[model samples]
Target: MDDATARTQLESMLAELDRSITVLRGDPDAPGDRSLADAGADLTDADRARAMLDVAARQRTAVLDALKRLDSGDYGRCVDCGKPVPEGRLAARPEASRCVQCQSVRERRR
Candidate 1:
């Protein structure tokens, strides 16, 4: 996809994630502000919200990093091995910083 299209998609995602983060944080006047007194249920809900928040935050960071890479003319290149990342991969994950093989290696190490 073109940079403009990618930018639009990323911006949309960022907006949605920001909204979700806000809601997950629990508004004082909203239903989400209920006390965490139900030990079992509230704990589960809070845990899930925390997990989602962490994932969304990481995704937002990645998208922002991708935008920076675009400005630096380094968007579609693998940060690990300096190889050209495939357009298909970029289309699927515009924030990817590693090619398939390198990504696999990194995951295995983890």
Candidate 2:
């Protein structure tokens, strides 16, 4: 994908992630409005919200990094191998910083 297209995609992803994070955080203005009387149920909901927040935060960071890479002319290059990440892969995942091979290895390590 072209730089312009990639920038647009990254910006859009960032906006969506921001919105999701905001929703996951719930209303900051109302902190003591727990409807559930059961402490276990409240804890479960809080735990789920925390997990969603963590995922959204990670996604936001990736999108921001992708934007920085665009500024540095390295948006489509794999950080691990310095190879030009495939355009199709970039199209599918604008925040991807590794090519297929490097990503596979990284995932296997995990």
Candidate 3:
């Protein structure tokens, strides 16, 4: 994807993430049904929300980092190995900071 497309996608994702945070903040205390099973379900919902929030946070960071790279004229290079990341991979994940090999190695380490 081109820089314009990447920026647009990142902005959209950021907005969605902000909306999600607003929803979560609006429900600071989760309401639960009377039954134990129902309460458990509420906890499950909270867990899912938390997980989504985490993902959003990471995505936001990734986008911001990508933006910085764009500004520096280093947008398409892998952060880990300083290699040019494939356009196909960038199309798949615009915020990727590592080439496939480097990313795989990083993931394996994690």
Candidate 4:
């Protein structure tokens, strides 16, 4: 995808992620505001929220990194192999930093 399109998508993703993270975190300044984890524990709701928050935070970081790459004119290029990541992959995950091959290899190592 072109940088403009990618930027728009990435920015939208960033905004949504930010909202998710904020809601999960809760408003600390409010009256006795507790986090999602603190608000509920029955049926492991707190644990579930914590897990979701962690994932959202990590995804947010990825989006930020992708934005940096876009600014640097390095977006859509695999970080490991410097190959152009497929358009399909970018469309699916705009924050992706590796081609499928490289990503597979890295996952195997992990």
Per lDDT, the best of the predicted structures is 2
Q: If scored against the real structure, what TM-score would every candidate get?
A: 0.85, 0.90, 0.81, 0.84
Error at 81, model 2, angstroms: 0.6
Among all windows of 10 consecutive residues in model 1, the one with the lowest summed lDDT is 27-36
Residue 7 C-alpha lDDT in model 1:
80
**Model 2 lDDT at residue 17:** 94
What are the per-residue Cα lDDT tens digits for candidate 2 across 26-93? 86456565654756787888899999899899989999999999999988999999999998899899
Predicted structure 1, TM vs. truth: 0.85
User: What is the lDDT of every predicted structure here?
Assistant: 0.84, 0.92, 0.82, 0.91
Better of 3 and 4 by TM-score: 4
lDDT pick, better of 2 and 3: 2
Model 4 segments more than 4 A misplaced:
27-40
What are the per-residue Cα lDDT tens digits for candidate 4 across 8-101? 9999999999899888876545676567776665337556778999999999999999999999999999999999999999999999999999
Total clashing pairs for each candidate: 0, 0, 0, 0
Best by TM-score: 2
Ranking by TM-score: 2, 1, 4, 3
* Candidate 1 lDDT tens digits, 23-89: 8888434454455475568779779988998998998899889888888988888998999988899
lDDT minimum window of 10 residues, candidate 4:
38-47
Clashing pairs in 1: none
